[model samples]
Target: MISPRAPRADRRPVVRSHHGRSFTDDYEWLRDKSSPDVVAHLEAENEWTAHETSHLAPLADAIFDEIKSRTLETDLSVPVRKGDHWYFTRTVEGSSYGVFCRAPVASPDDWVPPAVDPAQTLPGEEVLLDANVEAEGHDFFSLGTFDVSPDGRSLLWGVDTEGDERYTLRIVDLASRAVSDVDVIPNTAAGAMFSPDGAFVFYCTVDDAWRPDTVWRHAVGSSSGADVTVFTEPDDRFWVGVGRTRSRKYIVVEVGSKITSEVHLLDAADPMGEFAVVWPRVEGVEYDVEHVVLAGEDRLLITHNDGAENFEVVDVAAADPRGLRDVVVPASTDTRIDGVDAFAGHVVVSYRRDALTRVGILPLSGGIAAGGVLRVGEIVGYGALTELEFDEPLFDVGVSSNPEWTQPTLRLGFTSFVTPSTVLSVDVATRETTVLKRMPVLGGYRSEDYAQARDWATAADGTRVPISLVWKPGAVDESAPAPTLLYGYGSYEASMDPSFSIARLSLLDRGILFAIAHVRGGGELGRHWYDDGKTLTKRNTFTDFVAVGEHLVASGRSRPDGLVAEGRSAGGLLVGAAVNLAPDLFAGVLAGVPFVDALTSILDPELPLTVIEWDEWGDPLHDPAVYDYMSSYSPYENVRSDVGYPPILAVTSLNDTRVLYVEPAKWVAKLREVGAPALLKIEMQAGHGGVSGRYDAWRERAFEYAWVIDTATRGARDDLESSAPVAPTLDA
Candidate 1:
């Protein structure tokens, strides 16, 4: 069979000048996505990609089937009690989306959620929203906000049909099951919630750059033109978000940048009232607010990084937020206190320690009961804080789904590399844990067959970076290095924790290993880790990933010729830079929606979310030093033709606003210029996240994984030939 010719983009060189420096961009024409020529080029690229990987169709199907078979197709999520109803979602065997439903509460004292059966609906079950039905006739559909009103009579929901991050919010009357014509809001951001009385809906709107910069409040029965602007952030660096406190006592509006934040609160009873600032904005200090009652008085719990690298909790009077305060949970160097969720009986503290997410419960003194009455044996001070311990040495656990302020049980979610997602309910008074639901794995999976472990890599600057390793116990070892996929993402202080993936089973079952490189830009160790890997120190993120790949190969856990590097989004940037730093360390590279053209993106403030990103990456437009530094390690700028680079696959969506499609398109074009066998797949109907439906997403992952597997075993499979006939060319 003859190999198809690669699609070559025409060179339309455009000179870009910044900080007394000039650069020529050959593929800048791709930036104009609306141009017919650009669309044709993208379509040609997709056609070439499909033709190149057509041999992996059978493997891709097998992998997708494995993922579907291992998953319980028809299942119901554990019901969660909120207000007067127990709400849950169900997924039918053939459906692409979930159906949200709720059942009436049995009694006022009924706190235990009703058991839901996948085969049948519970008694008195009311369907709130059927996403599958709503998604009909649309190629891409995303449900943004699914907030039910406090009275349970009204529902506020939002949907994005175009995958552009802008949503259309609408209210539906539960009794009549009719969408309100008067309350239709278009071009809204992702989150929106109904006011405490369910008469008002608070939502956010994005600016031209796609940043949520304004918060608005709309009357339930009013038109969009009559919606009042609650608050707006003039600074492009800050984004605004609106939500109510878990206690349902105050409406909260938060304005935050990458490094700083300020919160505003208003009495929930007043729909047209002024919101008071909890604390004035401070540079480099980030804090989150949670309403709680202590000593029979209203107080706000603040988890802040003010003068503390790792956050600390402070208790202050809610009536006078900036007044005198008491340090409830003091700052610690060994732990990072992320945030706090307050309830009537207790406060759940989410923190990170020993490179793992952990949760602790702190009972409030003089706590109020669900009936709005004070407990009889309440005290003034707080009870001892105790951690919700788990036996897993490496796992990710956090508080989840306990929306009620006076609920007795705290819902927590726990998962690890081998453990399926498990939801648990912990009694606030007795510290007793009850497993509410453990996601079923239909393909007879055993945890004992797989193993998870931690490893450390020494960076060039003597910094120790952590690496999370997972594989089949008997299949992967140092004595016989297996085909390995090393993943990394080190940006925005996001910590990539270990979680079980049914799709990953296809790899491990085939004697392949998977690993995560917790590099410096991530919050795995603490804020300090992220601090050392951003702005001027951004090169540390790339060097750290290269070090992990070197460590894996040197330690005999992976062969130099069988290692595949993979990352998505910011992590995609990681592998991109790593390959430039050390081209021979891996056999293949997979970058999904990668920020490869970092310098180019950051230099332009008009791009989507670019102004808000100045804190994560320095202000390259204004700072000459930053521009110079970023130019040194930016993946696109540093692509070298001299090195024997590995085979590369870049996956991006046409409508992705975060990192525009042109970044990868330009990067792949440059790679082809160097004679590298690079494939670019563009999803014309998707956003930053490739496909919407689960099955479509699974197929996308399978295609990428098949490429990884084929590249990793290229040495052994070189003799195999494709018996299949050539496919027809795609129309441009």
Candidate 2:
């Protein structure tokens, strides 16, 4: 591989004034993505990235092959019973996408899912949507909405071919197997669903700021132009979404912002009727509503954080949401009550406790009949909550895919760092759990060979941050540290839970330990953990990450010279800021679509999703204090020329609406000006998630892992280059 000179971005300085502060931005011109020069520069960056890392092509290919070989190429997901059909998805060996499929239910009493074989189709199997067929000519394809009508006669599905998130929805008649061309709706948001009777399809559309603001109801056979606007949110900070209740009784319109939420419900039978507000909007108070029946009386179970930072559930009359209230699940400081799903005789509560995701079932004393009336003997109050337990010390478990209103069992998904994804069904009546399916890993994989544990790091402010560690036993330890990858994403209250990945196994096999820095701003230790990390205290997210990295080194678990920090999206922002705060802490950094230029993006209210982000990151545009605070730690704004930095690889997508591609491009440009070894890889035909296909995603991961392995190992060999361990291959 021949070395190529890095692409130099021509600087044309632009002066901007904000809150009495003047800042000169040299790479601001790159933000005009429509300009031909910008395109040429991005292309040049891509070429430079390709040539600079050309030596790792074989390693990347080997990793890709290892991932593919370890995965079950031909597989079918566990069947989820919905309506009269058992719905599932099948992936063929050679296909890049899944084929949506369904088969008739065995009987009305058949609670167990039937066996499915990937090699052969089940009897009476119907292919609802073949994504491979729809994605034939397009470079990118994303299936957003796929909801079958209650009667199984109509299918309302949405597709995004450009990866920009604007989907085109189409309804197809299952009886005739013909797509209704007249019902095609374009420029819509991500989700859509059919009315209970299949008479109309309810969906949402985005406003100019890329926020879903309007909900529309379109008749089954009517043109999109004839669609009626059901509701529109006037507040730009709030995003509106439409969904159906589990009981299929009402269509719900959920409108929410970063700090508050308000729900509206309309009887599904009344498609053209107005939606009534369940609870009016109250700033600083967030709540979600779930409909349930208690002793034959209609009730609305509301989960709210009004007075409880960790949230609590209250049951109220459906007719009068706030009239009569009964505490169902009281808020606890140690636990974060996320959501609740109601059924005929049971309710599933999803929450986070001990920094792990969990699910608990609360059984109701009464059951529903065929006509949706309670048939069992009337009881007093709700039964005791039964939390589902897992054997793994660190695992993620939650209720999933139990759509039926009268399901006797609750479907759940469980996974850990060493455990493959497992689907389970727990009988609500008996509390008995059954494993329906476990994702297959083709290579010789053993859970006992790997170890996962929890560690804590003390931050400068005396706050303890949790870390999840995974490594092969007996391979690397305290005495002699090996190459390590530390990953983190601490924003939007999103938790980085324990989950299994086949591609990660390649790195683990190569004696590289993987760990997660559960820093602040994430919803790992409850709401307060997230609250203390955002807004004015956003710097904690970065400092917490640095503390975790230092802990790894101080504990001798990771070599100081072999630690690579990786983050994506907001996590990208995390690593970017952490590097600026402690440039000598990491050997390399991998930031994917990072919001590095935070102050610049947040200062402009017109940018996509900027106004809505004011809640998470304070309004720098309006507040002078916020401008100074953001400028103090903003990655691109804080980069210093005097400090020597580790090599960095910033990956971004051209069509990413969430974080514009110019962000990483500009950040890399600034890093390069400081003589930092920085490279940018821009996906020209992708979005924030990168390429759509499974194979393409695998290739992308392989490329990134190869770079991290090479960089970490090369950095590990400081004085004695030949003494460093060679990255193990499949044949090694």
Best by lDDT: 2
Please give the lDDT score for candidate 2. Answer: 0.90
Q: Would you estimate the TM-scores of all the predictions?
A: 0.96, 0.96
> Per-residue lDDT tens digits of candidate 2, residues 1-732?
666688889989999898789999999999988999999999999999998899999999999999999999999999899978999999999899999999999899887998877898888999999999999999999988999999988888999988789999999898899998899999999889999988999999998778899999998888899999999999888899999889988899999999999999998888789899988999999999998987678889899998989988888899999796777788888889999999988888888888998788777752322211111122355665767777888999987898899989889999999999999999877779899999998878899999999999999999999999998876665477778999999999999998999999988888898999999999999999999899999999999999999999888888657999999999999999999999998999999999999999998877888888999999999999999999999899999898998999999999999999999999999999999999999999989899999999999999999999998787566647677678999997
Model 2 bad stretches (over 4 Å) = 1-3, 366-379, 722-732
Clashing pairs in 1: none
Evaluated against the true structure, the overall lDDT of model 1 is 0.89
Give per-residue CA lDDT, model 1, range 556-581, as digits (tens): 88876789999999998999999998
Error of 1 at 495 (Å): 0.0
